[model samples]
Target: MKARTRTNLWFQLALVLTLGTLMAWGPAVPVQAQDVVVKVGNIIPLSGPSASVGLQGKQAREMAVEEINAAGGIQSLGGAKLVMLYADSESKPEKGVAEAERLINTEKVHVLTGCWNSAVTYPVTAVAERYGIPFIVPVSVADKITEQGFKNVFRIAAKDSWWTRDQFAFLKDLQEEFGTKVSKLAFVYENGDWGKGFAEQWKKLAAEQGYEVVLDEPYPSTATDLSPVVQKIRRARPDVLMLVSNAADAILLTNTLAEYKVNLKAVITSGGGHADPSFLKAAGENARYLFDIVEWETDINKPGAQEANAKYKAKYGQNLTGEAVDAYLAMYVLADALERAGSLDPAKIREALAATNYRSGPGMIVGYDAVEFDETGQNEHASLVMVQINDLGQGLERITVWPKGARRAGYTPVFPMPAR
Candidate 1:
């Protein structure tokens, strides 16, 4: 009886030891499986004239979401992964509104981001307001976008007026460096919200800058041949030619310049045409020496830029463009805001978005360095960059950083024409 009792005691002790060891080192306690999903909605032009821009943005947003998920997602949100739902706005206002509604109502997305065109952005913003969803504008440059005073809407991109002011400053620098006077300048723009808005801002800034506007013309977006307009510009012979159009129209005008040999000292393009890679591909040698106002630069290769480039190429088999960078950074901003807000509630996200501050690609720490918004929700510290279309026609070299006296000062005219 004593031997049996001793044996039983030994077996119980060994079993207890084994169980305790298993409890200590076994399978991580299964981690209570977090919800692990943060939903984001996108509205962009997927099939219209701006399709390429929209496509780039879509790919970048997706890439950012994937990367966030791979890194275990928002650490502050219990490791919740991001899920994105995209809607095609087709560059139309009504479609944008419908898509915005669908994204908020059907998909139940926690956040909204995208809409390449400002016109599309404006309508979609109304939907976001109605649904109480937080909308972040990535590439739309319309000045009134944030000026609408929608609390839920935040813009990470610079407004048109901001770009106009920066471009004028660069022009002044160009004039001073080259001694090439731009007393009379011609502004040509397409008949869209973006074009119209830029033209008005350009006129306002030109007046303030003491430049004479020789010609201010608005053409239909679908205008195929720019020969007539080119002839008109040639007749006026403005010292500088400023073009505001998409890639296609830009190409048309460039062709006209090549065909007619319009005598202009300097040609500048709005951010829309200049920032797109397709313009270089389409215009080739004609694109050389042209200047553009750009928001993002791939060559700048600041912190997080190379990683973004490589990841973007790996996923899309192409390099990042301004459109792609904007969307990618926008996603990062959204993620940061969500994580900081600690909840997917749209209102909280809006508050957090207003408070967003993080380092993004191209060496820019967005929402940092004084990202306070005015009563109009416009980011007061927004800045712009001047980029020159180089001889290679493949990339835009940074000319200057805006608001003056930054680390990278404005450019001196490298190929300034002799004064007439």
Candidate 2:
């Protein structure tokens, strides 16, 4: 009887052990999937004066996200999908801050991008830094945005100083080519961060270059008529006219110039004015003979650039705007950083981004190698290109690259200065 009882006890113990082992490593039980979603945020002006440009950026970003996801997602992170959330800042700084807060606190995005205007971008970047999110600035040109010394913020586009420097270099080349002195210059800009920042840079550079700035005018962004400003420029009668306005105001100024027949030897604009295709459509023939300093070219379809351009055209059913190109490049940069990091952790992504030095989509070779941050988190070596809007209103033709002596010399001027 004792032997039999011992045998039963052993059998019960073995059965319990077997059941526990099965429960611990059972085929019926499911394993949880790894977290494979990267959240990115965007703050852009979707329903404001700069909406035309902002919309293009928003579309480009969405397209890039879709493409990246379609290609088996992010391969470096076990095929993780990129999720994007966007907020319309309405081109207002205050609204940008609020949206940025929402994106950070509520949405809990890992990275932040977008904001077309410098005014909106400037404030939104601050919020991004406050929350320790990596912010990639695509289109804002204010020097201070990068100069603020935030380690988490990176801008792919040129600053205001760079733009002015490029513009001055182009002007010098034009002066040498035409044998005409660009001594007396007139400056007209909107009364905003972009306008003020660029205008100040131009003024300082003009002084350094020994060019005489005859007249300087700052108009309201909401100004209905630019006739008074046009008249002021006409009266100044400077050798060259430099306009710094957003697309809508740019249209207004151009229309005024055409209607009033303000004949000047040369009309040049900073990037914002004539960079968008809407400028050509709005100004029509008036846009002829106007020169603009731009960051990207519609032509010169380099390998990757051509592919991006084709994709943009296919998706939008029209040519991609400059802002769109920047947005696309921004996504490409983020993707490269994520791949290099091999993880989605914000700190790791930031480290990888600082080490990024790859060719962007097209028209850009990012110098992310040693992207050491100044106190303001701005990349010190950012550059700009000088693009001349041709009479045909197609892609901006490359006239000069920034940092003196880097221009394509002896190219025939597509939009030459009117006979003086």
Candidate 3:
């Protein structure tokens, strides 16, 4: 009985000391909350043909993540810091799949993003879905990525259907505005999911618009020599050439077309390679008067666009392309969702993302107003803008022209492009 009394007395003293410490500190902070880290896995092509755009995406994500962390991180979860893990897909579907599995099962990443090539993203989405991890696609414009009915897939860019629709609309508007009739249309594109999806829509749109299809050509983007393709384009003798190409191929096709002097009324391009900064330097005069559709341009008149572009240019030594802008905005979107989620659970984060209606922030530099997603995980507010590559005394810059309302002030588009 005496030994039991002594043990009870010691326990009482220890409890009193613990209460005293708690009172001194006012309240106890949960160590888990204060030290929580959100791990994000990113899979992008760091090498291979698409490396330029992939590097841009990586740089953009780094910049945004730095800004987010510096601004006190996710406030909702006791200031949890976001941790990023990167995997290079090498622009291969198999590589993307392996990386996704490793990131999900081994790296234990809470969320996943990327595999910029639609072909790569397509297979990686299945890996992510199998594991139930949230997959965020910034710029893979394939419509079927979201059409898979997977709950965890969310895309931030306009799908191929939307892009194709806008391209046709711009074409029609150009003809109407300048009183120049465009009848024969040639479709030349890379033979990939993205290009084929676009070509399919282009065919239907061409038929609906009552334009004759002069040439339908699908070439591999990796083709080193495009003289043969240019010859085919020249032989087709189409009034307008509608092209979908990647960076190297875009430069190749542009220069080759110039070398062969394949004169046409206009050259409308999908933004993938044509909007790349290197396209301007490599294609030079050849890329002039080319109209490309994109999500954002350096000259956009949005609130924070100039500042953001200035910062990105200062850091990366180049301007941001439509693909890079989506990546930059994506980081901001993830941060916003994390703040609302207040938990590291992927489901919570996905729910917050689905409910996201991000309108204003540093990342609102996009051409659109908001970043709200539709039921199918597609950003409904996302839209495309057409920009003409011309020298406005600024030494050949991309100037917004289509959608008339979004066109730059005091500038007129040169229709029926001048001959070289």
Candidate 4:
């Protein structure tokens, strides 16, 4: 045979061998379309006032799902990938309920999560319970959410009552640490289930601590101008101001407080708005010396936390907030349950979630050690860390400063925030 013909024959033999090897490898593991898809319905305030945090939660979930899928997905289900289907609650309880109904009946999502507003989550829980769908709440801290006697609802964050309890404990510690007395207390919050819930506990705790409640103010979260509320806080003459606000209002309240020069020993804020990624930038100097309670902060001592935050910041153009962290971890928690359940049945998934004691993983970057759920479907290990917003010579950042042990090393908390 000619040289060209011999060369052609050799190439054909090699091509045949390659094709045989590929066939023996079992069809190249199939395409994504052939893999099982686990649909997770996420209901959140994608519009209106809570949009910023809602967007953060969405981004976090997407990142986690992408990672989970990239890491071979759910092995037991033939490498099933999680598919997130989102519905906007618009911060309305009715809208949340309606969206929950649509996501369940129409989208046929196996698991449900979110509706960040506690009011929305409160009612959405019933809908999930009625449908026998497991609803994993990432950061909605309403006690009523887990207290509703529903087997399908689980919360991954400390409840509002727990938050309030910690707030007062921190206050006691604050007074002892600095040798400063905090006599008068003020409660300012959004007039919603979440804010009202926190305020109710604050009142009881204040009374128990023998601290006089100087002001109890609840304002609309949609209020464009918070000067009136700031004026009330200024006039209340409280030593410390406790706040529970969403993102927009959190910024508005902080700016207004600074603009009006509200004098107070310190400002303690719940994590929602105060923990927002954009809060420091939007509030600027006004957010300084503010103490906020959260489940996770950028300065946490956990392993992999800084790396995760760095990766997230590179992807999302902002550091991970507590809300973002919870949402991110919720995806991992759900992925864990799905892995163990080994089935798509909601009942099996629910059983797996109820028994979860997730200890270590990329998602375990939270301050807590584990993600164990109590009988009430609350993560017993879920706890809050108090972070002070200050410039540690690096612009403004949240520095963990509570529980004493977890406090950032070599950083002294500024109490009785200096006057502007």
Best by TM-score: 3
* CA lDDT scores, all candidates in order: 0.75, 0.75, 0.89, 0.90
lDDT of 2 at 255: 86
lDDT of 1 at 270: 78
User: lDDT at 282 for candidate 4?
Assistant: 99
Model 1: lDDT to the true structure: 0.75
Q: List per-candidate RMSD values in Å.
A: 11.7, 9.2, 7.4, 12.0
TM-score of 3: 0.74
The reply for model 2, stretches above 4 Å from the true place, is 1-35, 46-52, 88-102, 117-120, 173-199, 213-239, 244-266, 271-287, 295-297, 360-375, 379-385, 389-411, 414-420
Write model 1 residue lDDT over 20-42, tens digit each, in one string.
Answer: 99978754444333854788888
Off by over 4 Å in 1: 1-33, 45-51, 90-95, 173-199, 214-239, 244-265, 271-287, 295-297, 359-373, 392-415, 418-420
Pick the winner on TM-score between candidates 3 and 4: 3
| lDDT by residue (tens digit), candidate 4, 351-377 | 999999898898977766789899889
Model 4, TM vs. native = 0.71
How many clashes does each candidate structure show, in the order listed? 0, 6, 0, 0
For lDDT, the strongest prediction is: 4
What is the per-residue lDDT of model 2 for residues 98-201, given as tens digits with 9 covering 90 to 100?
A: 99898888988889897889998888877877878899988787778887768788887667677777677778877777676667889999999878887898
